[model samples]
Target: MSFDEMDVESIWMDGEFVEWDEAQIHVLTHGLHYGTGVFEGIRCYDTAKGPAIFRWDEHIERLYDSAKPYDMEIPYDKEELTEATLELIRREGLESCYIRPIAYYGYGMLGLNPSDCDEEVAIAAWPWGAYLGEDALENGVDVAISSWRKYASSQIPTNAKTTGTYINSVLASLEAESNGYVEAIVLNKEGNVAEGPGENLFIVRDGELYTPGLAESILDGITRQSVIEIAEDLGYTVHDDATISRGELYTADELFFTGTAAEVTPIRSVDDNQIGSGTKGPITDQIQTKFFEIVEEQPEEYEHWFMPVEQ
Candidate 1:
């Protein structure tokens, strides 16, 4: 839903809470012109305990890490940003919402060098449902291999979540939608399966899980790490560093995408070729079920995964 349709009223910006409609940035901002900003996408879930942020610490760490390569320093500390987010959610009275924290170079002299630009930060939260659609969570989605290849780390730091680097994803997403598919699978420079537009890819074969390693030009997704742990705890072997070819996707026993938004959505088909039974396979179901259970129930065994908003 758009911000106009939500009940949100305020956004935390540059150390203060401002009216959402008033949270504006100048057109001359360096980040806007050069894409020199870093950001994070986080989720606050209504769990059995209360409203909580899932893997908030990891997200915050990534936000800082993303800024490092650009030589940008966020003006606020981790505690500052964390408190600001919690207060924003509490003030907005949000039960479950998607949280976006962005730090970018503010208005400055227009040039390639951003040394003179001031750093600006803002946090906003809004309600969002299943990213791949609700039905996709159960029935799965159809995807295609994008003609656009994922940029290699040599060209850009693939590990960093820089705002400017997302043009690659935008192109891939546009191609997928225009091609009458639900999503796209991007390959790395070596023509091996890298990942989805925004999510990490996982393949299940012979009761073992295989995902491209970080070297495969994919983000080290927080959700991907969580799923690996959960699957291992359930007695499943996960090959976190496996190199998968494009052909393997069509022959896999099952496949899925993991991300803060997509969660554990299954991939039922690739380029119209049925994956296994062309449905959410049994292993995918087990892992997806456990993922939702942990988020909704906030079981004590996995308590470290959540940060209560009330705190």
Candidate 2:
């Protein structure tokens, strides 16, 4: 849904709540021009207790980690940001929503160096359903191998979710849409399966789970980590350092992408080749089932994964 149509009316910015329409930034914002900023995409699910954020602490930590490579420090501590986000959600009266916390170089000097510019932070929440589509979660999505290659670690800090790096993702995802596909799968410099435009890649073969490691220039996604832990706990062996080749996509038994936004979506076809059964595989179903059970159901054993919001 569009932001205007959503129920959100207020945004937490710089320690104060501002009307959604009033949270404006200047045109000359340093991050806008230079793309030197860090951000996080978080999801708050409507649990029986209230709206609780999934893995809130881990996501907050990653936001700070993302800013480190650029030497940009978020002026506020984690507590301040977390409290602000929760309050913003409460104010919106949202049962479920996507939360975006961004720290950017705001209006000031236009030079390449952002040290002279102001560091501004804002937390905005809006109602969003599936990122790809609701059907993608159940029916799976058609993917294509993008001609664009993922940036190598030697070229830039791939681990950081910097605003500039997403330009590459934008290009790849656009390519997929133009080619009549739902999403794009990017390869690393060495032609290894890196990840999707904004999510991590995972393949299931022979009842095992495998994904590209940290060295593959793929972002260490929190959801990706959660799935790995979940799979292991469910008695499946996970291989973290699987340098999958381009041809592997065509032959993998089952494949899926994981992210805060994508969640656990199955890939039915790649480049027009059908995956196992041409649908979500058994292993993918099991993992996805367990993931939602924890996120949406809030079972006691996985309680630590959620940060309950008291209404």
Candidate 3:
């Protein structure tokens, strides 16, 4: 849904809470011009206990780490950002929502270098449903191999969630959607499967799980890591470092994409070629089921993954 359609009211900017409409930045902002910013997408689930953020600590750590490559330093510490996010949700009375924490260079000189610009940070939360669509989680989404290839880490820090690098994803997504596919599977420079436009890809074969490794020019997605652990704990052999080829996607028994937004969505087809039964496979269902269960129920076994909003 669009922000205008939501009932959100406040946004945490820098160290203060500002009215949602008041949260604005100049067009001359360095990050806006040069994409010299880092951001994180996180989820807060409405669990049995109440609203709780999933894996918030890890997300915060990654947000900071993403800034390292650009020499940008976030002004707020982890605790401060955490508190700001929690308070923002509480103020908005959001039981379940998607959180976006962004740090970027503020308005200053227009040169390619941002040495003189100040760093600006903001956190916003709003209700969001399944990214691909609610039906996508059940029936699976159809995808196509993008004509566009994912850029190599050598050219850019593929692991970092840089704002500018997403033009590659924009192109791939546009290509797939224009061709009538729900999503796109991007390939690396080597013609190996990298990941989805905004998610990590996992292929299941012979009841085992496989995903592209960090070296495959994919982001180290938090949900990707969580799913890896969840699949392993369920007695499935996972090849985390496996390099997947385009041909392998069509031949896989099942396929899925994982990320903060996509969560665990099954990919039913690639290039219109049906995978397995052309629907959510058994293994994919099991992992997706467990993932929702953990987020909604907040079971003690995985309690460490949740950070209660009330606390």
Cα lDDT, all candidates: 0.95, 0.92, 0.95
Instruction: State the displacement of the C-alpha of residue 230, model 2, in Å, after optimal TM-score superposition.
Output: 0.9
Report the C-alpha lDDT of model 1 over 1-311, residue by residue, as the tens digit: 87689889999999999999999999999999999999999999999999999999999999999999889989999999999999999999999999999999999778889989999999999999999999999899999999999999998989999999899999999999999999999999999999998999999999999999999999989999999999999999999999999999999999999999999999999999999999999999999999999999999999999999997
lDDT of model 1 at residue 43? Answer: 95
lDDT of 2: 0.92
lDDT of 2 at 35: 91
Look at candidate 3 and tell me the lDDT of residue 216. 95
lDDT tens per residue, model 2, 86-162 = 88888778878889999999988999988889899999989878899989999899999999999999998898888
Better of 1 and 2 by TM-score: 1
CA displacement after TM-score superposition, residue 36 of candidate 1 (Å): 0.7
TM-score of candidate 2 on Cα atoms, chains taken together: 0.98
lDDT of 3 by residue, 1-311 (tens): 78789899999998999999999999999999889999999999999989999999999999999999999989999999999999999999999999999999999898888989999999999999999999999999999999999999999999899999999999999999999999999999999999999999999999999999999999999999999999999999999999998999999999999999999999999998999999999999999999999999999999999999998
